[model samples]
Target: MSWGTLRNSGQERELFKRRSFVAIIAIILLTGVLVGRFYYLQIIEHETYATISDRNRLQVQPVPPTRGLIHDRNGVLLAENRPVFSLTVIPEQVSDMDALIEEIRGIVQVRPEDVESFQRRLGERRRPFEPVPLRYHLSESEMARLAVNRHSLPGVETEARLVRYYPYGRLTAHVLGYVGRINEQDASRIDQVAYAGTHYIGKTGLERVYEEELHGEVGYQNVETNARGRVMRVLEREDPTPGRDLTLSLDIRLQQVAHEALGDRRGAIVAINPETGGLLAQVSTPGFDTNKFVTGIDHENYSELRDSLDKPLFNRATRGQYPPGSTIKPMMALAGLASDTVTQSDVVHDPGYYKLPNSSQVFRNWKRGGHGDTTLYDAIVLSSDTYFYKMAYEMGGAEMADYLEHFGFGSVTSLDVSDERAGILPGPQWKRRVHGEPWYPGDSVNMGIGQGYFLSTPMQLAATTSVIANRGARRPPRHLRYIDGDIPARHLLPDVVRPPVEMGEKSDWEYVINAMEDVVHGSNGTARGISPGLNYRMAGKTGTSQVFSLEGEEYDEDEVAERMRDHALFVAFAPADDPEIVVSVLVENGGSGSATAAPVARQVMDAWINGFPEVLTNQAIPGAMENNGPSGRDPQ
Candidate 1:
């Protein structure tokens, strides 16, 4: 058996050799595949792999440029930028958000609202690893505490950034407006790349109107970062372009004077330089401190401002709509002459009240016994309600509306003024569209005296008066005198120019002007008491707008609530023959135009003509005729 086994050894060896060769071939194929894979990754795809590695270590960041400065015509700073400290956080770097927030409370006075706001921003889509603002306006003590606790807090950071500041406080709040922190809504509207590091945006007024010029170009930096995602160094950078400065036409001195003249009363005043259409002063009383709005106004303070009874937040100059009252009489007189509805010498017999041909409603005159026989000039000086009532009936609503539209009424006066309301100038079509009713002759009578459906803003009134001062020339009100920068000439906006209102006879303009002049200077003028110590001659009109209908009852000022009393209004242009300024004043619930509003206008005009010396001197001494008994409260 052993000998037989020895003969089969050669056959077994052959089989073993074949099996070993097959195993060697299989191993060679596997090694070749491994070598090919290494070559492809290291050589062919080197650039792609290297880019991925570099991205993890480097980041591109945006830098916001400095915001523009705002100044008045006198070079007085109205708005500026001040550096402030803020606390910020990066959510991804935080291990436990709630725990981190609780820890932050110990170092600083971190409010629940702050944490809530931070959480809200974290949920919004933003650049990855960008720091979110937690709290602004950090005090020195808070900064110290943060610095000491920095090592323990992973994501917390303290940054110094420039924030918007209003120097005039409540004086220019309505005109200059204010800036506020950018929110999700702002983020959606703005260019994300341009606004990457920017936090503030203009909220209203001139700030909003010229936002594009105020917000500068963004800069970028390629930065190397560490494993923790902190910036190690800036590898490359592109500098940002600064925003252009703006010099507004507002005269701060006049603005302050007008504001002080209004005092505690809720009122508005708009003064325009007749020669240039520049708004010298725009004042809305009971204005709030604009500084609080810039760095996130506290919720309690904001709520107080939002719900105040006096409405300090309201921009009365551009938004308040009130019946023009007798302030529109001069314009109405011009409209009469222009449309051939009435002649300068036309006479109307007034017996205290006027009635439409078929209507039972009787519109009463301010005088119980009216000016017996009144001409156009007599009607204006005495503010005869019956005379204008008949004239309004003659001209009709359509004619009156068309004439007034050319005077910048029923529309916004300035494109630069934000949130301006177009006042209502009622006509037949307007009545049908708004009230779903036909225009009545009674409506015409009421509107003729600037009541019922007629409403006008202070800005519109000032613009209209400018046309009268210029003898038919019209220039829309403007805030920007000029923009200072390297802007292309073609890109600049054209100056606002409007077509002049044509009168039937050139002599008609002088006739109306002379009548307005008599309103303040005539012996029997309603505002005659305010004319004694005039350094200049001025033409003016005074008006009273009723808050509620008397319904045939005599208006008793003492019986009415202060808020429900009549509104006093006055419009005037100084140096009547060669006017330089046009002013419109409105006093809400101020009772009589002569007693409350006219004196204020006189003071403002005196300030503009004679400078700040006159303002102080006039305030020290009362007008000689302060005893004149409420003669300027015209019938509405």
Candidate 2:
């Protein structure tokens, strides 16, 4: 071959080799790029894809803790938790909720109220997937019937929850209060995260005051779910902490006795341990069933309670304010003795009426013939209004008002219940501000006898009686006893002391106490009717507050309508020498403090001193009723 031909052939072979090398390099680079992309997607971004996959399958749910129980001082269960089966529906899960509910109705008894409640909750602003309650507190028969057909019903579920119970029923209704369904108003104020799965909350009394401690914490769980949001298994969970337990100061036995003693009378009874200031019983007649509020009460039932003349919803013990009448005589006499304005032996002539130094209006005594001449002790024991009227005038309005305020009059007691009324304490400034009128001498006379514009609550009377029993060691009354369990610590009680009214030298506190005892034990004593079978002595003062007047006429119970009669009041501390309990009883339009109020007080004291009969027998509390015996009739 020629030299040129050899060179061309070698160049062609080299060119072909260079093209093969370049192609091989391109193939290797493309393989490397593909491998890198696959590695990034499968290994580096694995969690991102997994999370996206889970988004289509997992469910989260809340678990509510059981509410704690409540007991009285004597270890009797007062408030308890009862298991309840409820039916619910998740709107998002139901293909047609209305149709499903209608279908379920044919199998079970469903009321309009149930339908209305379900619809109302359905309309609320909430997540569509969350379950809404349909029926609560299901009956055993109903649960059994529903169970048989549960498999056929789609999106319908049965859940077991604890329902609050007041075992004492209406007896302790006002004090323990009741729980109700969480409404929009309550939802607005509650912590959404903490109360995520809860439905009920305390509405009033101790229940409302201790809601945080009573309601346990909520817990959450994350679960692996299917495409339909059905739970397969829990991936993680946080356990819920239970609510705290409470020990109350109430004595269930004493509460029952007080409730029974009141009968049908429209008034209140407050009994307390004099030493510790613990409330033994607080009875407010006409209290409604606390169970009605739990699990949501119907409109008709609720309306009946709200519109009833007896005011079943009203709490008369802590809320009723009334003119104290002759119940103030003993306290006033004590004030006179402590202030050195009057001595124990000090005598005042009674001419049946009191004339405020320069006034024409005569304040007459209840007895038309007047109590001849009465000493401070006799005046208190007899509850002679004329004597107090004179003493009040002599002491001046400002002094009397100041001293009475020291006794806890015209002030809210420390019962821990919210909405306590601070009654009127008539003074020159108060009169000017409230009634826009100047103080009058006649006002002082009336105030001294626990009438006129002076007003006080039954709780206030109990507090004052406690002070008297303790001989001036005033501890504000309390309705609850603190017990640490799963509950948050209760709010600390504020330091309180009744003003230091000197009880030493000139104070005739002893004389007044002695006289009060005599009223129940001595001859011709006003309250002797109820004292026949007493084991211990009790010092008390009786009172009659006029509900109506005739400007210049005496009251005749026979002619007056039953509703317009005078209110009977009595306040006492038992075992006078070493007082253990202080009691205050008031009967509306019952006439005669001795005949009406004293006997009720006697029954209460007996229950506290001996044994509570009804409690021992495990008898159910009778309805609010009154004794119609001759003793309870309008007095002659």
Candidate 3:
């Protein structure tokens, strides 16, 4: 610059102009690039950025559907729904689940079981932002306290929802069962998407059997939530469909009478419609409140019930298996007639006991001096053990099994409920399979009296009696009568196609029924005590099953404990000409069927006939029931 700076102002001006032009061109290029970038970002990618921003404040919430309702045949609501407040929280919004739960515990009452149940659900597989219930069945004060501190607690919500309720909890506990909250084990068994917002599912009885119809479809809603995950408002909503309601064949009046009949006794009663096979009444005494199971039952109450000696949770009608005792006498009579093992003219002179072909063991009768020269009709009327003992042995185990199978023994009847025990029907094969022993002649002799390994449930007895009333036609016992929209196929199926009991002579049905009629109508019948007020003809059989062995000694009720005594049982059907209702009763540790179970059955049948006059013109007979049975139980 020093060499060329000798008086060159004109050249220096030209250089300055060139430098300014270069700087202006560079500025223009930089401005073009900045504009292009702004256009791409604001116009081309507009929807993408907007969606990303909305994701912070928008959410899709699940709407759980309402559960179904259950009703008796008379339209009496058995199971329903009640509105309640529950506290729920989203783990994604919650910074610390444990800390938030602790804060909730401080604000309101939080039971240890609730916390424990919540923890179990938290570990289950779940989607993001899905609210988990912290506490259910919250009180008004608890909800108010939670609301006061809700602002500080993000991701927490107080939701109002409907929960299951049972109107007659104790009366229908075993029949309808209950629902409980979804837990980890339940989550594993269910479809998470289908049960998104639903927290309850059926656990037992008809509830479990009809779960698909009882739980409806879930819906969804697009909602705008705040920074704390509190829902501001719903933008788009889809309504959830409610579950289908159920109408059962059970009669509430009959159920009440049966329950009352079993008052304070740990027993069961099952009544059936002989024509339609509808379960008119199913009662199990010492029942617990089913509502307690709807929500989480407290640990203390649950433990108390679980440890109780009476087994209130047990369904005696469907599950309690006891020997049929003399209740099977009429059925055995039918078997004898059908198998040609014995004829109506055949007679056996009983000397109070019978001995097997070569065995020395003497099987005695209930009467020390048995009915002399007993015919088939007299055997059923007098409940002569010696005659049945001879018949059972002659019929043989194979023939017995085949005939009894047609009567719904050795298998679960087509009852809709899932929990049912297939009462034991013992034979040579069954004995070998279960006891690892061969069937003996003594076994057959004992079975003649409905003892020794021949076990049956009160439900089975009721169904079998229905078969008898139908005169060899079989109708499988069922509970469902109607549904909200479409009824299940099982309700009116299978039974219709099943073949009627093929008999040597169908008129024998009338013959056996008449013999049973004399048991209640004849002067010297075993159940004549309940026959005084019979407006219409009735047929019945009385039975007593030994709880323990007597070892050839006389049974003294005074020496036996109440629980260790014999179980009294009865099977009967009204209007022997055209039976409408068939009832089977079991009295735990009751002294005699004639004294205990017969009276109970009379009350139930009277209630059915008197309550529904259209069914029959029946009036309640004053002093129709009597307890003047002998001091000794029906040891037969």
Candidate 4:
């Protein structure tokens, strides 16, 4: 057996050849598979993979369009946009958000509220890759410091953006309103794609009303960026469409004059162009600086405004409701004439007070010894409350309400004005619904003189006067005169159109207007004190509304608290024959309308008529020589 195994070399060689053949075949198959895979990746799918890689290096960014500018009728800037520096952060680019925020605190003063707000926005649903603002309105020094140390920060950036600014400060705060940083409530309602890079939105007044027109179209750009998300260069861009510029009906000069005249008083004044229905000047005193609200007002500053007794944040011109007092008499007189309840020649014997035919509850007149044997003309000129009491009693509440509604009472007057209150013009139905009582004769008497639940806003009062100036033609008040240099017709606001107030006889309008003229120019007119220089003919009525019920007690101005006293009011139109401006003034806690409120009306009227005379001239009265007295008469 040992001799046979020694000669087995040939069998061993054949086994080695079979193993080599298997190894060679495996190598050839693997080489073919590797070549096919390389071709598939390098040639067939090149475009798709190339696109994926380019997306990592390049980004599509949104560019916010510039906001529109706002100007007054005289082309004075009310609201404008100014460049400001702000700190922003992109969360996706940040590796450690807490560490980056801490580092930013060293370069810039970041408030806790700011950081909290930033965190809140970070959690909100926003466009992908958009930067969130951490701090706004940065100082130049802070920006410089951040620029020098920016190399160490990855996601932090200092960007210059346009911010809203009001040049008039508090003068136009109520009318122009303000812009504030976008919040959760605003973000939810806004178009996210359009506002991708925008951070602010209008909060109130005209700004809020015209937000869509003011916010321009958003644009986009393709930009190359580094690993840290820093933009290296812009490749392609689509320019944005700018917002439409606005021209308001307000006059800044007149606004300045009205604000200065009201000085330190809590009141409202509204002046409108009777012909065009455009607001000439709208002012609410004790207004706060609107700029504070634009950049997120601090808690302390906001509390001061919100808690102040004067309510600086309130828009009194459009929202404040006050008793019209005698200011309602002119409209009431027109209402009486329109309904034929009382004629221009009808007489009422005002004997210090009025009483219902069956009830003994006497409604006393403002004048203790009342205007005796007062005609409609004499009653208006002298502001005889007793005469109006009788007229209102004769007309009844329903007829009176229907007549006044035609002048836009108890309803919103302007379609364009935001947040205007529809004041209460109480009638039988309104009284029954609100007080759960039937309309009593005494209620009519009290309402006749603009009291007993009667309320009207300064805007409404001005609109009423405008109707009288137009001789029963109704034109709703409007602030927007034109948009983007396009002046459509004279009265552009067609939506605010109201039916014309018709009188049985057209001459009735002239008769009532003449009586109103006598109220300022007549020898016994209640507002005669304001008719000094005869530069122009004006018609006006004075009014006083008691804050508290007198209950048969005489009003002693010195005894009552200033805040508890009567409110002074006046309504007027200048150049009586061809009226251009109609104005209404309301002074809170002012004792006498003729004394306290009329002078302010005179001053404002003079401002509009004579361009706010630098120095009031001393001219002789029109009939002072015959009267043999001073140019000006004492207020009644």
Candidate 5:
């Protein structure tokens, strides 16, 4: 017993010692590995890990400051920041997201758009602790309801935000385009680092042109948050630098006046300060509500706006292309006089029609009986197509194209807003290049009268008129006056210089200006209707552009559809002696300038002349004359 028991005890003690040795070695190896890993992390990646940890612990969320305000030439606010309340959610603090959404839905109507937007953001894999906005611009009732039910809903909150508002709504929609949500397309175009927390971006018009000035630099706030993502105390904050204010060349009163003058017409009116080329009023009729595009327009509303018959979304002032019709007669007349093709006194006997050199197809006059024995002055005043046809025969298309191109025909005006069409300046080269056809005399005849392939935007027409008013000094048409306190006095850019628009002699311009004045004021003038009550002498040309080609048969206004009727057009500069403003108006399917467009232009000119007092408030008339009142009616 003593021998076996003693051996067993010794073996048991040996086995125990072996196990302890192995255990000690294992512990030592594990401890060495842990120490090496800790050293690697602490020494090599210390800065990165420290930064990441700090960021996670004290996340500095962006607090977007108020954007810059926009005012007219007068200090009346056009665009401003309005206080808006929104609902938000913190996913990390929420246990049941579906239930929370449902709960919010019961309290305040949560739209599919809200759910879809949140889901899209979640898919971006943003941090769960950060709060994401769900609904914006919440009503007071909705906010109160959410606040009342906050005890039952965790991780849900309401926040106050500054939203963009257009006080005039559809009145200034085209000129002051609305801001929209940042999308994939915008992200690709924008610098992600620069726009760290920006949600809305300018999509078009002045908003897009002055984005840098309008979007303020982002600011950060450091607030201590609890384990459940509730803010405990504010540590520090970097106050945001608010965006700088902008003052546009636009006259809000005039803009409102012009908008009303259009009166449901589908067209564009561009008015510019001929002295400085500052755009005073840019009105596009059938304009959509800019507020809808801002924040976010719903699918149905967006579709309706997009698919409407009137095409309210289209910016006709800058983007629309139309044949200038007789409105181009003044430019043609100037071209003829400047080119020495025709003299002011040179007489052309127009017997209702003008036959090109060899061709028998006669280009007929609007007045089928024709303006007999018409000179350049008489031709311009009457808008004689027959006289221009003969001039086209003498000058040819290439020479005429060269002359017209000087007045911004078939060219962009380099406007502040994007998307300007250089209307068709069809020459021998352009016709050959694009249409794969040779230039002909008939083409020249059509181009001479602003027909055939020649097309121009209302902005271009206004710009061209400004050149005439300024006596060949072509100023750049500018919409934005200043950006971030920097004044844009003249837009005559250094890199781009339009070859001096020389009309051969100053007298040539004078003759054309005289004829244009006659067209507005003369007894036989087509636009005489506008002159009956005008206090200031305005020089203008009336035009009627046929939407549909007249196939030899005379147009019966009664038989034709309203859409198929001729578009009335007028280009004018006020106070002929010292012209300040140049305006171009196009009334879609309005038939004649004298009947439809001239009246609208008259209202615009009246506003500009009278210094745009509050609309319809005629308390006292300072310079009210008896014979010349607004639209020939006595000033009320």
Candidate 6:
């Protein structure tokens, strides 16, 4: 230590000075580089970073308008909106979406679909703080549980919004239809931008047909969101346009009466106002509660409705295809008169069966011993198979079909409902196209009896009956009575117009109508049983369409399985001369039109005509249809 201190004192002083100078220079250069980098970041890229920051707070959202209300003619709400709560989540507020959803599941019922839908929406969202729906239609109890746990969850909120509600759910299901969640098929067909805020779309019936009017224009707004992704305020908004209110021609009371009249049977009843061409009631039973469809029907409940033998999902009033049976005879008789194939005075011998010129095959009548030698009036009143068979053979299928088309057969009517069936009105051309066979004389004979290839829906039958009620004048079988408030909704279809059935003889309208009246009023008429208690004149036809051919065997009602039995049908109009209402009834597998179907029609008709008995007290009317037994009898 003593040697080192004496030898290196000067050398050490110079070396230390040199090292200190080098260190000071190095420190100065490093500080200059740091200052330059800081200036570049803080000043040059300031606006770019500011835009990115703002994007995380601001979002554009759709402002959905209120859905339109639907009402019957009497202002009874058929479809209306009611407040419902849905659980929504702000994505930015939750540290982890999955963890929060899992936590919320413990508080309220969280379906797997809700989670799946939320995940999909989260990825699609452009804004950082917008709320996404997690669960829809929260029950009161579920809402209470979620409220109790609100303190634990930061981003979850219960949002109140109006949802579609059907008060008379099962009563109006078929005609009014119901709204449902938008699905893939719906998304493909609808305008995506317009539907951005909406979840439901019309699925069937008038709701589908008038979708554009019912789904109003979509509006937009810019929103400011907080760091938690909660909407702090709406920055700017364009007002949303609400859908137009629609008014229907349906009478709620008549709808209830007809629905009750069907009563556990698999059937349909369609009633129309002949003067206004508006549907009073359209019923298909057994009906399901329409409210179930508004949000989303569970798979199990939908399965029960779809697989049920009763087929409540099937809109039988407009979609059921059956042999028109004797229900079509009035139209046929009019066709024969116009074509001169048969006349009112013409007579035919009914020996219980009809046979073609050289054919051994026999077409048996519903009556084993038919009315021997019947006129056109008696033919319709007694429902003679031989009389119509003779007329069909002479007029031929093509000519008969041409006339029937004028009465709205071989096509769907203008019922303002979607998916209505246009029942088959077959002829030689149709048979050749469909079955690859030419028409036969037997085919014409079957057609005469409203069987074979001939088919008609209850909707079509109601319109046809109304044509007779109007004395050959025509009108659409429509349900919409008004749009908004006073707009008329009839006399035209999308691309079709039904012309009046002009007769070669003007008096022929009365001629066929008289025969129809005899069916209900005549002593030996097929539907005479309903005549006794009638306060006002009624014209009706009873029909029994064979589900399977008799093939020369006598029909034993007791021997047949209930479903294998014939379809009982009836078509009627009340206060015959000044006709107001036209009703068509079809009882699937019901035994006799007179017994099973006519009574149902009578109850429906009486509901309209004999409504407010206190005011109609001067007029003696049967207070209830129970006064009349299941009435009418026919086939052949």
Identify the leading candidate in terms of TM-score: 4
Model 6 residue runs over 4 Å out of place are 1-46, 89-101, 111-134, 139-141, 144-157, 490-497, 500-502, 612-636
* lDDT score for candidate 3 against the true structure: 0.83
Residue 582 accuracy (lDDT) in model 6: 93
TM-score of 1: 0.89
Model 6 lDDT tens row, 1-636: 688667977898999999999999999989998988887777887788777877888878888877888887756678888988999887777887778888998888888866776777676623344567788889999999998898788889898978899888999999989887676668778888887688778898778888888889989999998776667999999988999898887877678878888999999999988876778889999999999888667667889999998899999989899999999999899899888888888999999888888888777777887789999889999999889988988888888888888898889786577878899999888989999998888788888879988889999999989989988877778888778877655433332345555665768888888888889988988888888888888899999888886655678889999889999999999889988789999999998999999999988887677662332222322122221222110010
Model 2, position 122, has a per-residue lDDT of 85
Worst 10 residues of 6 by lDDT: 627-636
Question: Per-residue error at 196 for model 5, in Å?
Answer: 1.4
Q: For candidate 3, lDDT tens digit of each residue in 481-583? A: 7788246445434345244466547778888899888988999888899888777788999999989888867999999899999999999998789887899
- lDDT per residue for candidate 4 within 1-636, as digits (tens), equals 698878788888998898898889889889889988888887998888889878988888888889998887645678899998989998988889999999999888999988887887898876677788899989989988998998998888889999999988698999988899888789888888888778789899989988888889999999998877789999999988887788888877678778888899999999988887888889998999999888778777889999998899988889999888888887888788878898878999999999889887888888898988989888888889999999999999888888888888899987678889999999999999999999988888888989988898999999988888988788888888778756642454663455555755778778778888888899999888888885889988889988998665788999998899999898999889988789899888978888988888888888777654333221211111121122111110
lDDT of 4 at 255: 81
Query: Which of 4 and 6 is ahead in TM-score?
Result: 4
Q: How high is the lDDT of residue 278 in model 1?
A: 78
How high is the lDDT of residue 16 in model 5?
100
Clashing pairs in 5: none
Q: Estimate each model's TM-score.
A: 0.89, 0.87, 0.89, 0.90, 0.87, 0.88
Ranking by lDDT: 1, 4, 3, 6, 5, 2
| Candidate 2 structure quality by residue, lDDT tens digits, 328-382 | 8878888887777788778988878887765677888888878889998888777
Question: In model 5, where do residues sit more than 4 Å from their true spots?
Answer: 1-53, 90-97, 117-131, 148-155, 484-499, 613-636
Poorly placed runs, candidate 4 (over 4 Å): 1-37, 489-492, 495-499, 613-636
Cα lDDT listed for each candidate: 0.85, 0.81, 0.83, 0.84, 0.81, 0.83
Over 4 Å off, model 1: 1-44, 485-492, 614-636
Colliding residue pairs in candidate 3: none
